[model samples]
Each structure stands twice: as C-alpha cells, then as structure tokens.
Target: MSSPRLWLVGCGNMGGAMLRQWVASGVVAPDRIDIVNRGDRDFPGGVRQARDLPDGDLPDMVMLAMKPQQIDDIAARYGERLAGVPVLISILAGVEEAALAKRFRTGAIVRAMPNLPVGIGKGVVGLYSESADAAARDQVAALMTPLGLVEWIDDDALFNVLTAVAGSGPAFLYRFIDALAAAGATLGLPADQAERLAVATVQGSALLAAAADVSPAILADRVASPGGSTREGLNILDREDALKTLLVETIRASVRRNAEMAAAARQSAVGLGRITLFPFVLSLSHRPSSPRTGTRRTALRQAQGERQGGSSSRNRTKRLSWCRNGANSDCLEGAAMVPLYP
Candidate 1:
C-alpha cells in the first residue's frame, strides 16, 4: 500500500503519545507526518510540524486528536479543510463516526481510542467504524497493531461504553496502584520505597495474569494458602461481594457518562441544544433501567421538560443481561450506538 500523507491536529498528551509511538516504531518516517496545532508546538525530534493544514492539496489521511469538548471548535475550524480525505481518524472522546462524516466529508472515519501505554508499544486500542469497508478496516487495524492489541468494535454505540472501560479503565487501575502504595506507606513502609514496590508489583502481577494459562480466579486461589495473608485480604473483598458491587457502580458511572457524550455528539450533528442522559428507570427486563419507584416519572418529566425548553433528551433503550453459564462468565461487554441524522 502507498503511504498516505498524514495530517494531525491537537497532538498533545494522548495524541502525542500515539504519534511518538508511530515514529519510534519506524512505522512511518519522521518526514511523512504533518502536525497542525494552534501554535508552533514542539514535537518529537523528527516529523514535520505545520501551523495549519498545509495550504494546498489536502492530506490523504487527517486525524483529530483534540478533546471532545473542543470538538465544536475543531469541527468548525478545520473540518472543511480535511473534507474528502480518504480517511479521518479521531481520538477525541465521545465524538461519533457519523459526527465526523458530517464535519469532514471523508470516505471513512474511524474512532481510535488509545491509552497512555502506547508510548512503549504496550497500549490497547479500541477502534470503531460503521462506514469503512474491508480494506479500509484492515488499514486502520494494521496501523494500530504496532501499538498493541487492537480490536475493531462492530457496533458503533458500544464505542462509548467500551471507551469508558478501556480508555478510562487505565486511570482507574493506576489509581488503584497509587492507593495500594499509599496504604503501604500508611502501614509504616517508607513512601519512596512503597511507591517503587507498588508500581513494580502491579506490573509484575499484570504480566503474570496476562501470561497465565489459567484464569485470574484460579491464579488468586493458587496464591492464597489454606489460611494466609492473601486470604485475609481476599476475605475483606469477597465479603458480600464488596469489590464487585463497588466496581459495578464505578463502571455504571462511566457507561452512563458515555451515553451523555453520545448526546453531546448528536447535538453537534444538528445545531440543536445539548443531549444528556436523563436518569430514568432503565429496567433491562423492560428498558432504560429506571429505578423501581416514582423516580421513573420524575425522570420522564425532566426529559419532557428539556424538550419543551428547546433541548431534547432520549433514553436510548439500554438493556443489560447476565448469563454466567454461557461463554465468558465475568466478562461484560456493551453495545452503544447513536443514530445519525442527515
């Protein structure tokens, strides 16, 4: 395949890390990449950096790496310039593929979600695209392979939820590591020593889990003897399934917010007011998982209220189910898609 001319806007932290990995891995030479930012921003040692979309011909591929909140400015300012590009990849959170199609008349738009670990070629990227064909899909996948395990999400709506899990999941895990270290320090270990051990311990454990042929549950069992220290801590977490409950709410919060983002992206598609997820009684057995009480009526009233006020919110029927006896027991995946208006 011929290497496509690349254009990047807002190559900061998350985006910068992806680009840095691309360059370091020798997937693309320094000179082949072009960066466009607000100012004359400094970049990795190599690669061409431009103040604006290079004046003349459009690039073959244009990617947006700015924040989701900045999508409006990004769409308004640079959208037209990159229109009709063969591929437009967005790393912005919450922005949907349909939104990209409207902003930039691209052949295809792919949402590429990457975490910080991509810098050292140890990241996991979740990709989604409803419009791209087989070849186009392969191209995107190939580009991401060097970074880490790349999976293409077949359903678009699931993007946000998956993004919530994979994209935001790292920060949650990192915080766990930090909390563990701090707890160690609180128990009398030196802070500096505690931090090092905590980080290394997590890294090693993660590697072991990833490499192990057995499941994590089995692995945990192997670590805890008939009556040991690991078992003591395990008891605390296992009591009434405390950890699972805590994580359920944690994941629920992220998924709920992702729906909010879908609303945001849809709002941008049309010049309508913001879209938000009304906390409605979302009963999976029914739909919208609303609480069992009078809260459902209140949420519905608020949704109606928004429409009357010129903004509209819809409870895109969300249904969740569990079948432990099926394929993967503890594994929970979601499907989230927002219909696009022409």
Candidate 2:
C-alpha cells in the first residue's frame, strides 16, 4: 500500500529522527512528507521543508512534534485549516488526547511517546488513543513498526508510567552505564578503557538477554557461578533488593513529573477556571458498634445531617457516610462520601 501523506509540524531532534527512519526504511517516501519548522534544517532527500504550512489539501496525517507548551499557539494557528484531518498524532510529552481534541478537530488523536533511539530505528514508542478507530490504529501501528518496539497502551492513566519507563528509559540506562564505568575507574582501571568495557559489556548482555528464552532474572543466574566474584557483586545489588528499590523510586519520580506536565496541559486547555478534584473514599476497617441498631442509627444520623447542611458550591467541602447494613458487623464497611462539583 502507498504511504500516507504526512505533515510533520516540527523537524527537531525527535521528529527529524523519525523522519529519517521513515525515509530510510521505505515506510514513507521523501516526496510524500512535508516538514514545517521555524528555520531550515537538513532532511531526507526530496522531502519538503517550510517555515509555514503549504497551501494544499490537508495531509492524511498531521503530526505535532513540537513542545507541549506550544500546543495552544499551534492549534490557534492551524486548528481551522486542519479540521477533520484523518489522523492527528502528537509526540508532545504530557499532552493528553483530551487536551488535543479540545484544541483541534480531528477524526482521531494519538498521543505518542517516543525516545531518542528512534533515530536509529531501535526505540520504544508508547502510544495511547481513545478516539482512534480500528483502521486509524492500524495506520499508526504500521507507521511506528519501522521505528522500533511499538506498544499500545489500553489505559490512558498508565500512559505516564509508560513514558517514565520506555520513553525516558534510555537516558536512565545511559546513566547506569556511566556509573558502572566510574566505579571501575575508581578501582584503579584506566578511565577510558573502563568506559569502553562498560559500554560493550552492557550492550552484549542486553543482546544476550533479548535472544535468551528465559527471563532476565534467570539469565542473571547463569552469569554468576555458585560461589564466585559475580555472586559477591550480585549480593551487593540484591541486598534488600536495593537495585530494584532504587529503580522503582527513580521511575516513580519520572511518573510524578509526567503527571505534573499532563496537569499543566489540561489546565492550559481549560484556562483559569480549572479546579482539580481528587476523589477519595473513606471506608471504616472495623465496625463502630456491635453491628446492632446503635452504630447504624448514629452513622445514618450523622450522614443525614451532613447532607442536609452541605452546600453544593465549589468553595464548600462536602462529607458523607452511611451504613451498609444495620444487622451485620460490616455494616459501615463501604461508604463513599466524596466531594461533588458545583
């Protein structure tokens, strides 16, 4: 099948990388792609580049590869022109599909998180879309196939987690490699030689793990003899699961930052009237009384009083509580008394 006509809004690092791979892999012809950027830059042969979008029929796909903060400016400028575009793919981090849909009218909007390795077609692309139909999804999957490992996220909430892991994982791995080299250098080895050895060791190990049928944990066991130097090193890393804990904390930090960005994007879309609501349900672990009428009566009275007194205003806080059954010990087990919007 012929490749879709693609208009890339930004030809910076990530976008340019994907563009190069698409052209080199024959997934997209240079003539079929157009790139719009603030200034001229190198691109694959036959590809068109311009400071402004060309005047022609809308392309089959419009990719927003610019920074997330530029979403408003870009949408305001091209929203009308790009209305009803078949597929809108955004590589802007932290920008959710809802935010994009609110700004631009499109048949489908896909949020893609691709790392830097996509330049060499060995990256991980995490994609999430709620508006895409089956065909649109297939087109996106096909486009990313040449880039690297493409994963479709079913839950939008987990997109940030994926961004933390696959999208930002390369840099983390690079840091680990650097640390390994530094440790080796500290042990009296030549710094340059240690760096080279560290890089090669990590590369070979990763390749082996990928080709092995067993999990990485099992492969790690195969590398360490029953009572050898490797075992000593492994003990240090595995002590109280130190390495695992450190990684978990690191990824969690990334997840939190991604969530902040997403919130900022949503706030930008909604303007100053945005109010974030966090819903939490408080359930009593133990029964208040002997599951008789005493606990049920008191709980119901308090809930009724709160409901009657509460105001349905954004400024006012609301509370609710209730009993599930009057005769059971778990009567007041679950009582959802969450704050409601005005």
Candidate 3:
C-alpha cells in the first residue's frame, strides 16, 4: 500500500523511534513524512523536519507526539491550521480523546499508547478512539502494524490499564532483569557474566513464551522438574502467588499514576476554558432515616436563613452545606444552583 502523507508533531524519543521503524519497515516512506519540532534533531533521511507546520495543504494524518502538558498551548497555536485533518493520532500519555477533541478539529482523534520498544518494531500499541470510523481506524491499525502488537481498546477507561501493562511494563521487566543479575552476582558469578546471562535468559524466555501455544504458566511448569532446583526457585515465586501479587501492585501503581496524569490534563483543559462540560446527573444516595438527617436538616435551615438575610459569605456556605447533604432536598436545590466544571 502507498504511504500516507504523515506529519509528526514533536519527534522525541518515542516519536523518533516510531518514525524510524515506519520508514525502515516500508510502512511509511521517509519522503512522505514531515516532523515539526522546536529544534532540529536526527530523523530518518528523506523526512522533512521543520520548526513549524509546513505550508499549504494538511497531511493525511497528524500525530501529536509532544508532551501531554503542551496540549493546551499546541491547541491554541495550531488548532486553526490543523482543523479538519483526517486523523490526529496522539502518543501523549494519559491525554484522552475527549481532551484532544476539545482542542483540534479533526476527522478522528486516536489515543495511541506505544511503549519504548516500538522503536525496534517490537513494541505494543494500545489504541482507543471514539470518533474514528471503521476506515480511519483501519488506517491507524495499518500504520501501527509495522511497529508491533496493535490492540484496539473497546473502552476508554481501560486505556490507562493498558498503559500500565504494556507502556510501563518494559521498565518493570528491565528492573527484574537487573535484579536477577544482581542476585546472580551476589551468588558469586562475575557481575558482567551475570548481567549477560540474565539478559539472555529473559530474552530467550520471552521469545519462547511468545511462540508457545500454551500459557506461560504451563511453560513454567514444564521447566520445573518435580525434584529439581528450578522447582525450588519456582516454589519461592509461587508461594502465596508472591510474584503475581507483586506484579499486580506494580501495575496498579502505574495505572494510578496514569489516572492522575489524565485528571491533571482534564483539569488543565477545563481551567483554560478550552473544553465544555455537559450537564449530567450526579446521583448521591442517603437513607432518609439516618441519625445524621436531623443535623443535616438543621444545617439546611441555617443556610436558607442566611441566604434570605442576603449575606454573600453565608450564601456560599449554604451552597456548600447543601452539596454535602447527599440525597437531601437541600442537595437537590444546591445541585440546581452549582455549576459543574469540566
């Protein structure tokens, strides 16, 4: 298939890696790609690199590879020029499609989470797009196929989990390799030899797991003879599912961090008034017969009295009180008056 006219915004480590892989794999021709960055950097030969967007017609697709925090500024600066681009693929971690939609007017906005390994055509790309039609999605999948495992996420919420797994997973594996090497060195092997052995062992195991029809758990069992040293080591990792538990916590931490980053991006976008909030009901439940109801009732009465007295400070305090009294009529009244921020 012929290459799409692609423009990469902010070609950094991850972006540059993908660009190189695409050109080398023939998924994209270097001559058909353009990269925009503030400063010059090494890029694949025949690809255009510029300090700003190129003149004339927009490309078939524009990929946002800049820092997540730069979303607002980039939108403010280039939104007009980028309006109606066929596709806007973002590699910015934690920045969602909703956030991008608020900024750029495009046919499709795809949130792609590609790990560091993608540079070598061995990475995993997790994609989530709500606006992209079937053809646009297929185009994205085709563009990512040369890079590595490409999985389309059905739910936007799961994107962070995917980021935690594949995006931050490589670093976790590297650390595990380092720990293995350190353990080997402590057991009397030369440090360099131990490091080499650890790396090779991990690489071979991963390749085998990838090729194996059975699960990695089955493969692990295959390697552990009933009375073998491998079984002894396996026992330690299997006890209380220690390795599994540790990895769960590790991935959870990463997922949390991704969520935090997403929240920050959304907050920033809202703070800048670049995004609009749709009116939605926030259901809050409370038992009417609860002992606290009387206290809440008294609080509501006080707030109403204060508002009637025309005290601005007291009015604000009343609104806050009503918000805290979930399910109470006062809360409903407060909900009517309170403006929800996006």
Candidate 4:
C-alpha cells in the first residue's frame, strides 16, 4: 500500500523540481523521499531532509540530482554504500553511466538529463541506462512519468545534444523571449509590457502548435495573411534558416563543453601516475556537523587523497560523460584504453 522508498541526494534545482512533481501528482508519497542536501532549499511539503545520510540503511533506489561538478563528492562518500542499490539515476550533465557505475556499484545505472521545466508537468526528461532487465527500466520510467514527457536514448553520445535541446533549451527560449520583447520595445512599447506580451505570444503559439494536427510550417502559412505583417516576420526568420542555423551551433557548443567535463571526470577517476596530491589544510577542525563545508570538503579531500596516493590507482577510476550531444543515446563502453582528456 506504500510507495517504494527513494533517497534523493542533492535536491537543488532539477532534483528539487522532480521531488515537487512526484509529490504533487500523487505518483509518489511525500514520506518516501529522504533528501540529503547541503543547505535547505525548498522541497515539497512533508518530504524529509537530512544533514547526513540516514543512519539505519540505504533505500532501494538513489536518485542523484547534484550538478555534474559535484559527482566526485558523491562518489567518494557514497560509492561504497551504493554497491548494492537496485537502481541509480543521475541527472548530472557530462557524467556517464559507466562513471556512475564505477563510483556506485548499482545493479543498474542510468543517466537522466532533464531541463528546468520539470517543476511543471510539461517538462522533458531523457534517460540512458544499462539496466539488464525490463522491469528495472520500467521502475525508473514510472517515477519520471509524472514529471513530463519521458524519452530514452539508444546512443549515450546523443545525450549532450539532448542536454542542449531539453536541458539548456529552456534558457534559450527565455533568451529568445527577451530578444522578442526588446525588439518590441524598440517599436516604442514599455519594456515591462513588451516582456509580458512577448511571453504570452510564445506560450499561446506553443500551445496552438501542439494542438494542431499540422506541422508548424503549415500552421505558419495559416497565420501569414496575404502581404501581411506575419509574412514579413516569417520572411526574416526564414532567410538562411536563421533560427535553425543558430540552434545548430548553440547545441554544438553545449555538447563540446560537456565532453570537456567528461574528460576531466575521467582523468581524475583513474589512479594514473599523473594524479597529484593537493591536501586540504583547513585551519580549524572541519567536522561533519556543518554539512555545508564539513561534509563536502571531507568527501573532496578524501577523493583527492586517494587519487594522489595511488600509482596505477591514479588511472583506474573510469568515467562516463556525454559525447557530442544529439538524439543518439549511444554509449562508449570499454573506454579504458581511450586516451584521457586533458
């Protein structure tokens, strides 16, 4: 009669949004979440928050929602405990399923990339998992269903592209809104009023496009009157496929950076002789009580120490990161021999 237990680590923006949706839609009960975050951000009412890991035992599943940069801290502190978890889902960008599996030995590991819209039910979520069974994948999908449209990629390499489109796409849309509003202001409307009108137009148009059976290109024809203003605007956007061209590069840049981070995470994972020791020298004793500095720093110092102290250990920590992002959920396994990124 009870919802399955789920432990969430690092519920800031994306994680926090998932928690909000899960509880609001009644897909998961509030009591099921045991959130371990650094500082208190907002969470759905009645969801649990803790300064540290729960004492008794691990939950059946762990959904890691921290930024990709925070993966090292997670792996250092929680990797050993994660060995037996049935499923592990990561929403961090640039991090890969293999890297996650190496860090946390879950029976199945999934990398999930979701955009900010997930706070509302209209968001988009992309999933990549090497789960051995259908049941395991289904279990993960059911939880994400309430948040928004759920998509799984066969090529993990495409995740970088998905991240740009879905994950960073919202920001891009917001920017376009700002551009439209600014252009409207140039025509003498007050900036505040222009902003409101621009946002409303985009929202309504999006809804209209969604409901219409015809493609957006066809819908545009219905809007453009003979020699009318809408046609003029469409001509400008259509010239050189301006919007399409800009978006191609926009996604390309995002995917390129994701690859860079992946390389950094991988380089650190292996205990290669290249690892260097950078010990943490805090002036006073850094205890775990102050979850902010204490817990995180403790984990980082430990990961760094272990990396520096190893010979072959330096290069043995393998990692998974998004390749040039696209629709492909393609994964690059057996990257052991792949040259480490600088």
Candidate 5:
C-alpha cells in the first residue's frame, strides 16, 4: 500500500531519527512529509521544515514528536488547523489518548512509544488506541512497519508498562554495557580494548538471543559448564534473583513517573496561556539587545498577533520594547509567565 502523507510537529531527536529511517528505507517519501519545528534541521531532500504549520489542508496523519510539556502549546497553536485529521499519532511519553482528544479533534488518537534505536530499524514501537477501528489500526501498523517491531497494546495501563520497559530499556542496557567494560578493565585488561570487547559481546549476544529458539536462561546455562568461570559468575547474578529484582524496581519507578507525567498532561490546560508564550520567549533569549530589525522582532510580532490578534501601534511600540528588554512576569501583566529558558 502507498504511504500516507504525514505532517510531523516538533522534529527533535526521536522524530528526526524516525524521519531519517523513513526516508532512507523508502517507506515514506521525503516530499510527502512536512515538519514544523522550532528551527531548521538538516533533513532529507524534499522534506519541508518551517517554524509554523504549512498552509492548505491537513495531511492524512499528524504525529506529535515534541516535548510532553509542550502538548498544550501545540494544541493552542494548531488545534483548529488539525481538526478532523484522519489519525493523530503522538510519541510523547506519558501523554494519554484522552489528553490528546481533549486538546484537538481527530479521527483516532494513537500513543506510540518508540525507543532511540528506531533510527536503525531495530526498535520496538508499542501502539495503543481505544477509539480506532480495525482499518485505522492496520493503517498505523503498516506505516510503522519499516520502523521495527510494532506491537499493539491491549490495555492503557499495559501500554504505560511497555513504555517503561521498551522505551527506557535502551538506557538501562547501555549502563550494563558500561559496567561490563569497567569490570573487564578492573581485571587488568586494556580499557579501550575491554570496552570494544564488551560492546561486541553484547551485540553478538543480543543477535544470538533474538535468533535462538531457546530462552536466554537456557542459552546462559548452555554457555556455562558444570564447574567453570561462567558458572561462578552466573551464581552471583542468580542469587535471590538479584538481577531480576533490581530491574523490576527500576521499571516500577519509571512506571510511577510516567503516570505522574500523564496526570500533569491532563491538567495542563490551565497552563495553556503560559505555554503559548514559549516560542516568543525562547526567541528573546538568543536575540541581540536591540530587537530592531531581525527575525526576532518578526517572531515577537507573530506571537503578539497569535495572542492578541494583530499588533497595534501601542503594542508594537511599548509592549514590544518591554518584551525586548527581556520577557518577565510583568511583560504580560497579571499573567504569571516567564521566558522559556528561565
């Protein structure tokens, strides 16, 4: 099937990675993808990037790849324009479907949790959608196919657990790799060589585990002789299921945090006014003292236009000067807002 036209909001680290893979794999043509980001990025040829949403009709799908905290801000800026999009896919961690639905109108709201490795087509993408029909689900699955293993989560809570596990799994594994290398170095091996060996060992072992029919436990046992160094090492990790216990606690902590973030996202409506000032406030931080004749002034004017619906002489002169001096709580008057950086 042909790929759907995709409009991406906030092409940061994870989003940029997915874009690179999609373009390279020919799953989605670069020309068919539109990205709205805070600034320019070196994306594939034919892909368009701009500070604001493109003009004209919406695409078949819209994916939110920005920071989870910016959800309200994005909705405020583009919610009307995005009304009735076929599918709205969000990769923001901890934000739920209901939160998205409350902010914007869409046919289906899908929450996708993807790890960093999706850039290499080896990541796992966990999808969950309560309102989408089978056809919509299938369409989403097909689009995510080139990214990696795509699994549809049955329950919302389970989806959160999956995010804690798969989405955060890569970082935990990196720690283990680093520890393994450090252990080798402690045993007097050259540090650089130890790291190289440790990395390769992990890479080869993961590939083998994936291909093996037997479980990882069986593979470990198969490697360890009745009386050997491997067996001795296994005994330590196996004592009282220490490794498993540690990992369970780690993931449990992550799950709790995800829930907290979800709650915050749901209640973020109260902060929409403050969130709307983010882009303009961010621009102020990098701008020169004199915002006389640059994009900085243009951005300020744009923010004023967005907030107050056109800039007046008084707004352009007095308020603009006040903001250029530096954005503070007083700039907006009675609105407890600060610059994006502060």
Candidate 6:
C-alpha cells in the first residue's frame, strides 16, 4: 500500500520524535508529510514546515500534536479546511474523541498516547477510538507500527490508566534510576562512578526483563535466590509490598491529574468560565510563543484578540479577567509546555 500523505500540526518534541522515526523506518516518506508548527524546527528528510496548513486537498491523515487547551483555537482556524480528512489522530493527553468530534468534522477521531521513547522506536503507543471502523483502525495501526508496540485500549477509562502507566512511565523510571544512583553514592561509592554503574545496571536489567519469558515478579524471584544480597534488597522492597504500594500511589496520583486535565479539556465556554485561577495559570505558563510575535505578551494579546472575536462570546468577560490576572512577568517567563500532558 502507498504511504499515507500526512499533516502534522504542532511539531514540538513529541511530534518531531515521531516524524524522525517515520522517515527512518520508511513508514511515511518525507515528501509525503507536511508539518504546521508555530516556528521552524530541524527535522530529518527536510520535510516541509510552515506556520499554516498547506493549500490544496487534505492529506490522508491529520495528527493533532498541539496542546489540549489549544483545541478550540486550532478548530477555529483550520476546521473548515480539514472538514473531510479520513482520520484525525490526537496525541494531546486527556483530550477525548468526543471533544475532538465536537470541534472538527472528520471521518474518524483516534486518540494516541505515545511516550518519549517512540523517538527511538522503543516506546509504547496506547490507542483508543470509538468511531473508527476496522479499515480506519488498521490504517492508524499501520502508521503507528514503526514507532513501537501499538495497543488498542477497549475502554476509555482504562486508556487513561494506560496513559498514567506507559505514557508517563519513563519519567518515573528515570526517578527510580536517580534514586538508585543516590543510594549507591550514600553507600560510599564515588558519585560519578555510582551513577554510571546504576545506569548500566538498570539498562541491562531492563533488556534482560524484556527478553525473559516469565513475568517480572518471577524474574525477581529467580534473581533473589535464598538469602543473597539481592534477596536482602528485595526483602526491603517487598516488605508490606512497600515498592508496589508506592508505585500504585504514584500512578493513582497521575491518573487523578489526567482526569482533571481531561475534565478541563472537555469544558466549553460556560465550563471554562466557571473554572478557578489555576487553569489560567496553566494557560499563561504553557501558551506557545507566536512566530509572528516573539514575546509571550504579544502572543497572549493575539490570543485575547482571537478569544474575544472567536465563536464563543459568552466567556469573554470571564476569560479576559483571568488573562489580565495572568499577565504578570513571573507567569509569562514560566517554562514552555511539556508535550506529554496538557
């Protein structure tokens, strides 16, 4: 089958990662993809990049990699142009298919949650779709095949749970690696040497676990043999299921936050108007800088103009109030949005 012609909206970290892998794997040709991002980014295969969508027929697929908060704005700007795209895939965490359908007209809407490792083709992509038929699902699966293991989640709630696990799993693993290295250093090993050893140990262990036929629990038992050093350590971690409990709590917290963001994304002007200042803080901190205007202030002003003039005028007063409150220098200088979540 011919490679699907694609349009990628918002080519930031995650989008860039997926694009590189697609070109490398020959799953999608460079010339067949178009990227619309706020600013130019270096990408493999010299794929075309522009601030606006290309003029002509819509591509075979349109992937939304932008912020969840920007959904309404994106729809306002390009919904008409993308009215009949065969598939609309979103990597915006916490945003649902129903939310996408409400804003944009498309043949099918698919939610894809891909992790950072997808850049190296070792990541996990959890997909969930209610409207896509077998043919569309197969097409999406084929496109995502090169990135990593593609899982189709049967339940949307479970898909959110998977997002907490596989989607946000890497950062948690990184924390574990750091803590392991710190523990090693505390035990009198040289800091740098301990870090190197810790990293290598974890890397090798992960590879082994991946190759093993048995479950991780069984593998742990196999490594622990009666009263060895590994067993002593395992005893500490397994005591009252300390490690498992901590991880469960961690994932639960993540799941809760994902739900909050999903709830926020699902809100319309009325719901948005009722939200507290925290959401404004998120918007102010995470809003992208415009290519036309280099500063956040100008970009925000542009957004204010758009929001004031855009379809929903009901929340104009409330939104403007929040915008004014968030215009402080401290908030404007905050870090850019992490592509992983809202």
All candidates: TM-score: 0.79, 0.79, 0.79, 0.77, 0.79, 0.81
Over 1-342, each residue of candidate 6 has an lDDT whose tens digit, in order, gives 898999998989888889999999999999999999888889876589999999999899999998776777888999999999999999988777877898889999999999999999998999999999999999999999999999999977666678889999999999999999999999999999989998999899988999999998999899998979999999999998889777775665456445445544556733332233333445544442222322323323433443454443334344445445643222222312333263
Residue 86 accuracy (lDDT) in model 1 = 82
Which prediction has more favorable TM-score, 5 or 6? 6
lDDT of 1 by residue, 76-103 (tens): 8877777778878888776667666766
Please identify model 6 stretches exceeding 4 Å from their true place. 269-276, 279-342
**Which residue runs does candidate 5 get wrong by more than 4 Å?**
270-342
Clashes of 1: 11
Best by TM-score: 6
Worst lDDT 10-window in candidate 4: 319-328
Of 2 and 3, the candidate ranking higher by lDDT: 3
98-190 in candidate 3: lDDT tens per residue? 778878889999999999889999999999999999999999999999999999999776787788789888989999999999999999999
Give the C-alpha miss distance for residue 281 in model 6, angstroms.
12
Q: Candidate 5, residues 1-342: lDDT per residue as tens digits? A: 676799999998899988898888898989899999989999999999998988888898899998887887899999999999999999988777988999989999999998888899988899999988998898888888788899999977666678878998999899999999999999999999999999999999999999999999999999999899999999999998989777766665455445435544555474333343434433343332221223223333434343453323333344446555653212332112422210
Candidate 5 collision pairs: none
| Local distance difference test, each candidate | 0.67, 0.74, 0.76, 0.68, 0.75, 0.76
Instruction: Give the worst 10-residue stretch by lDDT in candidate 2.
Output: 333-342
**True-vs-predicted CA distance for residue 265, candidate 5, Å:** 1.3
Model 1 — TM-score against the truth?
A: 0.79
What is the Cα-based lDDT of residue 241 in candidate 4?
A: 89
